[model samples]
Target: MMLSFFDQFMSPTLMGIPLIALAIALPWVLYPTPTTRWLNNRVLTLQSWFINRFTQQLLLPINQGGHKWATIFVSLMIFLLTINILGLLPHTFTPTTQLSLNMGLAVPLWLATVIIGMRNQPTHALGHLLPEGTPTPLIPVLIIIETISLFIRPLALGVRLTANLTAGHLLIQLIATAAFVLAPMMPTVAILTTSILFLLTLLEVAVAMIQAYVFVLLLSLYLQENV
Candidate 1:
């Protein structure tokens, strides 16, 4: 029986237990813990530097009140980044490719930002549904449209991450399969395909990283509006 290219996206199981938890937990373990020593190792230094820079850049557009979210933003970014890159390796599953997992992450965080906005500034939050200078005739229609768009935010977040990762993985698999099948019968063609595959792999690695950053960055933007 031939397996689907998407079989790689499925959550792996061992016996009766799902390994998704392990895959999610693996990123934390792979990171080097900071030690008490005055001089840190190169790995720890690079890790610290990356975290600091990312947090700084992420928080820049956010308000002072939204600064409280720095930790959550940075942690989620690192977690997603690690999972995404790791999934590119042979035999690893990409959890973010699953709509369920992406929505699970998206809804709660997106809702929290929405809630904060409503709680902190009810008038301002409600005002977002109907912008200023609207013609009386179109007021009702505009509010309805804006309200629908507001509700669609979380769905957009979840689908964006899932779709990008899933598309990249599928494309990689298709190209790799082509390269493999052509290797024996058409060596020159296989070589050209292999080169394209290599470049695509590099592009996928970048897409993985960018998608993770965009996910976290959007959350921060939502929080910025509320704060």
Candidate 2:
């Protein structure tokens, strides 16, 4: 019974091939491609506008050097955003809910930012370990703590994304199961549970979008510090 709740998170397979690859690739196919026409359909127009706005806002704080990351940032944001929202659909699997996948996305990107900092400005990057005017006694302790915190960034990014989506998915399933079990025995209670489920579904949708944005925003902040 306990495992049933988590079964949705497992990667489904057909002919011994994991379907997660298809799930990850589906978002790209869903979006319409741009054409040479001056006037695009409403879908393409909206896509362009949203991408433009997101790119501008994301790069606003970044230095010109960091601005070079604009394409990667926008693409990641769209990929995450689409997958998260699509995962909310019935019978669909969410790739971002997996810690391994989230870490796969977070670690390299986080490392890239750190690498940029170290390569471009070694002094400034290393300086983050210990602040100015530190007492002689606390210097060692502070450096160790800061270094630990620096390494934990990728872990935090992965765990944060995984935990939020997992919790929301679990809650939705629990409420749904309850609503189904109680429908005949306690119609009133089941109705209330269903209503709550509807509200929670909406909140989860918002969370999906927000988490994607937050993930990218943090990367941008990391880049800002480095660049």
TM-scores of the candidates in the order shown: 0.97, 0.98
TM-score of 1: 0.97
lDDT of 1 by residue, 1-227 (tens): 99988788889999989999998998899988899999999999999999999999999988899988888998999999999999899978888888999999999999999999999999988898898999999999999999999889999999999999999999999999999999999999999999999999999999999999999999998898888
For candidate 2, the 10 contiguous residues with the lowest summed lDDT are: 1-10
Candidate 1 segments whose C-alpha is farther than 4 A from its true place: none
lDDT of each: 0.92, 0.95
* lDDT (tens digit, per residue) of candidate 2 on 111-226: 99999999999999999999999999999999999999999999999999999999999999999999999999999999999999999999999999999999999999989999
Residue 160 lDDT in candidate 2: 92
Error of 2 at 97 (Å): 1.0
How well does candidate 1 match the true structure, expressed as C-alpha RMSD?
0.9
Residue 221's C-alpha lDDT in candidate 2?
A: 95
Which pairs of residues have clashing backbones in candidate 1?
A: none
